[model samples]
Target chain A: MKELRWGLLAAGTIAAEFAAGVDESKHGVLEAVAARSGDRAAEFASRFEVPKCYGSYEDLLADPDVDAVYISTPHPLHGAWAIRAAEAGKHILCEKPLTVSVSEAEKVIEAARANDVFLMEAFMYRLHPQIRRLAELISSGAIGEVRAVDVAFSYNFATPRLTDPALGGGGIFDVGCYCTSLARLVSQAATGQDVVEPEEVLGMARLDENGVDEVAFGLLRLPGGVLAQLACGFQLTQDDHIRVYGSQGQLYVPKPAWIHEMRKPKTSQIILTPEGGEPEVIEVEATQGLFAREADHVAAHLADRQAPELTWAETLANLRTLERWRAAVAR
Target chain B: MKELRWGLLAAGTIAAEFAAGVDESKHGVLEAVAARSGDRAAEFASRFEVPKCYGSYEDLLADPDVDAVYISTPHPLHGAWAIRAAEAGKHILCEKPLTVSVSEAEKVIEAARANDVFLMEAFMYRLHPQIRRLAELISSGAIGEVRAVDVAFSYNFATPRLTDPALGGGGIFDVGCYCTSLARLVSQAATGQDVVEPEEVLGMARLDENGVDEVAFGLLRLPGGVLAQLACGFQLTQDDHIRVYGSQGQLYVPKPAWIHEMRKPKTSQIILTPEGGEPEVIEVEATQGLFAREADHVAAHLADRQAPELTWAETLANLRTLERWRAAVAR
Candidate 1:
């Protein structure tokens, strides 16, 4: 079996984390890294034990040894790098939210289609098995018909890195996107339809001095009359969890939002407390068991020339919702 | 001191609970009861050991022994009964939500002011020691500068009463209003503002079969970059809780929403969880507990020709928010 060769477009924290995820994946290998400076790229490459390093994203994408490229850059650079990687005919695993704006996300989609490259948004939590188990439970009507979904992903990001707007920082994009995505994912799974965008949006955002949204909150209306209340902020501390309620009982996944360490990973659990029952923690062997499984699924899909488990259509819908939310808050 | 002569208009669950709350109070008494039928009224009066019973709302307001009337009827009747009670020179203690519509709430406010009666929304939760404690902690900068507030009040009201729009029932109005009101209360307390309203409104709601909101969720933006995410629903089950986050620490009041059982009333606990610190639960005893405190405040205000602890101005601001939320969902 040929290992999927990975290339990273940035050598920052996110890029390093993703490279680590790929490195730890049984079916994938982190082969190359790129940064703005040759010295920085070489440093990142040496630290991660990658073989190749490039001074720029274009140079990394040109490497024939790279079968896939992960665009892990700041907000303004995501769309451009993703389009370039697509044009280079590399399967792209771009970090979420895919771009700074919906139009930019659309352009990335167009570029991927034009280049006939496999493209997927790197919402790693979706690939995690606990969420899949939740989806399965919800689809099977474990909670009967789902009535509402609530999610929050907030953390105190007073670190100057987040305080700066140029870094594509602030709460909404940094952490709020998780709550937004989780809410949509749960609502879609519950209703068995694409998330229906709210007819109107009412938002309250707290802004920092830089005019970036420090804390952003949103509500989404789904078809079949299900409401989703979502809160995300870099300025607050949240449990990084999601809850879905149905006619029968409610299922809660506490701290379900996580980016596992490449090493020393452990199984996560989903706590199910039916109305009249005590809480039962179902240990989810998601990291060691499921990441490899997800990688295998991606590899099989690539080999078979089929789309992965999550379709581009679903990804587009998710991005559209996030865009709508951002627009609502921007106003 | 004279007893607070009280009358309740409705013998439903809330009225029964509230009657018990009044009887348990050290300085109040339930003097009258009213229901749609004379038999039900008489039954409730006898059960609660009240002195008077009336077949109709007008008959109860005509009772000279009743100094104040608590309007505990269905949403559609709140405005009419409150207005009539005010005209009859009776102070009013309405339910959590002042009235069904913004205009109706306005009418209640006008009548209360015009008739010089102490009228206050029966948001008994507001008088909770825990809520007051939370306000105090936030004011004292225990959480540093307050930045975000999140609250949810949801339960599976999928059955008959909540799904009926004709009953003025739905998630948003029935309980979602609590989420909104809680968010507003937290925001006001944190910002040190007498009133707080979101600058931009964005909401998404799931409509029930009867076209009333089954689940409604929204965001509120306050001055100084404060953001609030709120959810209230009849379709989903969630803990009735509120969380406030600031720069230094976080304040959480677990189960703040429905702590209104008049008998087994539990005090809301304030848990301050700072970064890298163990959570400490702050137990606070109010000078007067919820229903009783509000009752005493109203009685004192009426007796001394002073304003109640909570003012109609706040009620009007809250109504404006409700109107905006309704309009956003309507769109």
Candidate 2:
């Protein structure tokens, strides 16, 4: 019931989207905004109506009024900013592809644990009401036993991002990570067992001139022989959709397929088609913004002095799969 | 053009479908009928108005009047029948998943070439007029530079025929093969090169009581990092659809998403969405039954004394991919 005071790091499109979510929230407040430059920070602050703006990340993290800092910088910078925010004694919410590499992710986690401050990956789609309801339906055998999962998050980002490897600009990091994360999340929920690391990973990626993956596809194998086929790209046009095929029926998430990109009404529909049955679509509306659910969940964890819903172990497992995939393509 | 004297190999569902295609063709004829029993062969002969009825495979192969034989038997027996038919100096049109394994497919190919006969893995869906148009469009840069391809072919084939491992029961071979084949075909056509073997194959499958794959998925990477994700199953219900995404536009073969499946008339359309432009959907009427185009193509190939439209080399490429996927699961 307590509103978590939030500080924004970086003034980019994603930062604005997250700030909008915070402003529309009932359990969170945009206490401040920050960027590398004072003018940019002030501009972002004015647009979002945040109470204060800071020219430096350290200044925002130091604000006594700020409880947590949401790090929305590029992939390479996520770890540094997260560790810095944690060191500053603020709880942290880092954007996805949490860090460009697994070692970087480890440093982020270490900083959070070392500082004893809450650290959560801002995977908003998983927190969306529709995804939770989907997990529920699959668990209830709505679609029968979980058999296969297909997840795709592709967009036309073939401009400057395709040419800049420094920004961690490519499909695997920018979009494929979401596909892989969702697979792990849904697999774990469906099997009622932690979705195990894929025994073998076969990844293929189109490397841009900058040597970053522009598009990638992967096959993940779960414990029960469940297969998740994930495809993502920054150079292709796409309709973001995630489909889980179970024995009884299927659940189709219409849009905002990932955790963070929450759509209005804050929900997606579950399409269930029972045997010899017609397809039924049901929409689920969540009580909180998908981003806020994690924030709320993290707050509750902080209040109870417990770990977040997704444990550090799960985070490590997710990172391992990602690292293996990246290594596969790099080779 | 020379007429193709076709022998109907079985009286099963697919055989009946092929008979209908021959019956409606101008350049092909049902010259012979073959089955395990004389009575069944007679019945098939009567139904299709064929000139000859043979009680056994040997008798049918010995019929010098038959110019070509269509092998519509179970997957496990495909190699044997195809090889036998080839040894008898007849061209062949074997059902999809050319043979259960690539090793077997190699033998079938060897036999066909030794006899200097036309041979084709009968993936009828690819020959559908709409599919041809879609492929042509993509090759013509109608969708601009292709980026990603997604294909799904699932049907609840948990029936008695599909439940038997002897019949190649399960989704991957039964249905998933089409998905993978389409992925490869589209990728090859889009990239203007032989589709490369995916560097790594990742897959998941639901095992049947017989320990064969029941529901399966595969993600593949071809050269240029083109990513193809495929989902297929016998347990999760049935859906046949293929979508090709490119830079300028996208083409959806709404019908016949799988090989040999009949696409309903006029339901196929190519949606062209150029960069910074609106989408245009061009509807194509089904020219005839899905098998008609394959029948015509085969007829043409035979007349020209050339290899099938989808050559032995292409079939070999497809079989290799299928073998790796099955091996990944079987291991």
**Index of the highest-DockQ prediction:** 1
RMSD of each: 3.1, 3.2
Candidate 2's residue-wise lDDT over B181-260, tens digit each? 77887777777775445656666566766777777777677654556777777776645677787777677755563443
Task: Give candidate 1 regions above 4 Å deviation.
Answer: A86-89, A101-117, A158-167, A191-203, A209-211, A260-263, A287-298, A304-307, B158-166, B257-261, B265-267, B286-289, B305-307
Superposed model 2: Cα runs more than 4 Å off: A1-3, A158-163, A194-196, A257-267, A286-301, A305-308, B1-4, B100-116, B159-170, B191-204, B207-211, B223-225, B257-267, B275-278
Candidate 1 structure quality by residue, lDDT tens digits, A1-331:
6898888888988776666666667788888999999999999999989999999888998999999887878777888999999889998877777887777888988998888887877776676777878878887788787777777787775676677777777777777777766776776677677544444444456666677777777777666555667777776777777888777778888767354323335677777767655777877775453334444556656743324445676667776777677766674
On lDDT, the leading prediction is 2
Give one digit per residue, the lDDT tens place, for model 1 in B242-327. Answer: 88888887888876735543455554477899865889998765554456666666676675433433677777777688778766
Q: How many pairs collide in each candidate, listed in order?
A: 11, 12
Q: How well is candidate 1 docked (DockQ)?
A: 0.64
lDDT value for model 2: 0.76
Question: Tens-digit lDDT track for model 2 on A265-289?
Answer: 4545677777678888787766666
